[model samples]
Target: MSNAADLRAKSTDQLNEQLLDLKKEQFNLRFQKASGQLENTARVRQVRREIASVKTILGERSRTA
Candidate 1:
């Protein structure tokens, strides 16, 4: 997971890519949980937070621009 500072340093395009990947991972994590194969359950929370962080950063940029 990326910290807010790191995410803020990335370009908007890079951030969008990161967000997409995080969403994909989130989906896989949900699938794993449904199948009872999820090992690191905490990862689901981390991914969710990371997605939020990326969205927040992107929103900030968009609003300011």
Candidate 2:
């Protein structure tokens, strides 16, 4: 997991790309859970939080821009 400071330091374009990748991962995790193939139950929570964090950061940047 990346720290808020690290995410804030990244450029908007980079952050957007990372956000896209994270969303893809979130989708896969959901599928894994539905199929009963998910091994790390904790990962679902982690991904959700990470997605939230990235969105929050993006919002903050946009508001300040």
* Candidate number achieving the greatest TM-score relative to the actual structure: 1
Model 1 regions more than 4 Å off: none
The RMSD of every model to the true structure, in order and in angstroms, is 0.5, 0.7
- Per-residue lDDT of model 1, residues 1-53, tens digit only: 67888888999999999999999999999999999999999999999999999
Instruction: Extract clashing residue pairs from model 2.
Output: none
lDDT of each: 0.95, 0.92
TM-score for each prediction?
0.97, 0.95
lDDT per residue, candidate 2, 1-65, as tens digits? 99999998999899899989989998999999999999999988998888898999999988999
Off by over 4 Å in 2: none
Error of 2 at 27 (Å): 0.6
Assess the local accuracy of residue 35 in candidate 2 as a C-alpha lDDT between 0 and 100: 98
